[model samples]
Target: MGFHTFDVDRADALEDPGRYRFCSREELVAALDIGDGAVVADIGSGTGFYTNEIAPFAGRVYAVDVQSEMHELHRKKGAPENVEFVAAEASAMPFDDDELDVAFSTMTYHEFASDASLEELARVVQPGGRVVTLDWSANGTGDDGPPVDERFALADCVDAFESAGFRTVDATGRKETFVHTARR
Candidate 1:
């Protein structure tokens, strides 16, 4: 199972520009490298921050969040035409098998990381599909985002994905976070 969830009261902070210090929009999008008209899901999407950023590039984007309040908050912000909010947990999504061309999450991997969740990801993403994850790293200094103890190290993430039968396309641990791309 995953760790504690983010407080919905801090949903406003999800839109803060300072968040780029951990993972920028460009980096996340580039890591996904989806083709035009690709179906994607933003797992654990909170306030649709990164979801909105990648919306224009996708044919459809499912903003999957466990908290309906986050979806309501994002709805108030006006979701992109292609974005649809789905109230679902990472371990149990409503998507069909091989439904998504890509699935990505920013800073929320720790909240949902589990064998079941990774298996669910492998089931949802199609063969040759991509899964991009950018989050606070366990190997980082306690400077920002979640505490290091609660975060997963790059190796742990890589092993988890591989164990889930996905191929690691790219993985890098930065100063305060790690970005990983896995191909199903």
Candidate 2:
């Protein structure tokens, strides 16, 4: 299904505030180890949460989402000079191969329509570029989070990335969060 039906305005309404508090933009960015002059892409960057934080550290950031309303919200929020909003599907990013130094998606991989999204992510990053993912931990218990089946387990995510030609570098579970860092 296309992402046009996604309600950008009500996106956060689907989330549990208390559970997401630990996955705050500040904490996620710090964990990324983002370097100066890095080029990054925040796929499924709803509302520019992670995009806004990483923009300052990176030379350029591509905030990509399929929904126009989502991109509209990101634009209205006024991203930094280094950030550019793009309307594109997660499985078909409009970026050249080896163009980005880092690619990140927060609470988004599970929402991807299929495995194509993982292929697209691996295609865009340089051979040594890193891919970082933070999503709901599958153990559940988060404050009123999405149904258990809708969430992607950390192991499944890692396997998908590895199958897409990414090498798993780290995997950790903290609080209600699952973080994975990999290299393409």
Please tell me which predicted candidate would have the highest TM-score against the true structure.
Answer: 1
C-alpha lDDT (0 to 100) for residue 141 of candidate 2: 70
Return the number of clashes found in candidate 2.
Answer: 0
TM-score against truth, every candidate: 0.98, 0.87
Candidate 1 at residue 178, lDDT?
A: 90
The pairs that clash in candidate 2 are none
- The superposed Cα distance between candidate 2 and the true structure at residue 137, in angstroms, equals 2.3
Q: Tens-digit lDDT track for model 2 on 102-154?
A: 98878776667357888888888989888888876777675644556667678
lDDT against the true structure, each candidate: 0.92, 0.77
Candidate that scores best on lDDT: 1
Query: Roughly what TM-score does model 1 have, to 2 decimal places?
Result: 0.98
lDDT of each residue in 91-122, candidate 1, tens digit only: 89999999999999999999999999999999
Global CA lDDT computed for model 1: 0.92
The deviation in Å at residue 69 for candidate 2 is 0.6
Q: Weakest 10 consecutive residues, lDDT, candidate 1?
A: 1-10
Worst 10 residues of 2 by lDDT: 1-10
